[model samples]
Target: MNEQKIFDNIKHALGEAPRNQFTTEMHLQMIKYADNLKSITAKEFCEGVGLKPSFGTEFSKMRNLTQRLKAAGLNTNQL
Candidate 1:
């Protein structure tokens, strides 16, 4: 994926500046949360994170955000 494009998309979706600091633990926490709530759906995940899930776009967006987080030095499995 185009990392910059994905980052920009997340920034626009969140309506906030990108965070420069995030630890592996934090990434894992979010991943775990997403995993645990199987039925929660990506729509719910976006809602929990304070985003609208009405169009089903947030689901893919959330995945991209997490992937970007991982690329930003957050470990995928270090919770």
Candidate 2:
């Protein structure tokens, strides 16, 4: 998909929730590691994107975000 479309879908999935709100950093990281997400786990994806990899830590959040992305037709298999 196109970059703008991908980004828009991600934003929609992220929503505007206060806690665990999506930030520009995550946005950039998603874009940066878009390709890797299809194959690697979220924890690995986080580390690949320069973030700490936490096992069973905040994994649910990533899974939920990925679900939202999938619902938005984002093809989050990479995520």
lDDT of 2 at 76: 39
Tens digits of per-residue lDDT for model 2 on 1-79?
5544544554545554344555554653364435534555666544433445752245435555655676677763544
Q: What is the lDDT of residue 55 in candidate 2?
A: 29
List clashing residue pairs in candidate 1. Answer: none
TM for candidate 2 is 0.34
Cα RMSDs of all predictions?
Answer: 11.3, 8.3
lDDT of 1 by residue, 2-70 (tens): 433433444354444345533332333345333344455556555555445553453544455766676
Worst 10 residues of 2 by lDDT: 55-64
Q: What is the TM-score of each candidate against the true structure?
A: 0.33, 0.34
Candidate 2 residues lying further than 4 Å off, grouped into runs, are 1-24, 27-36, 55-60, 72-79
lDDT of each: 0.47, 0.50
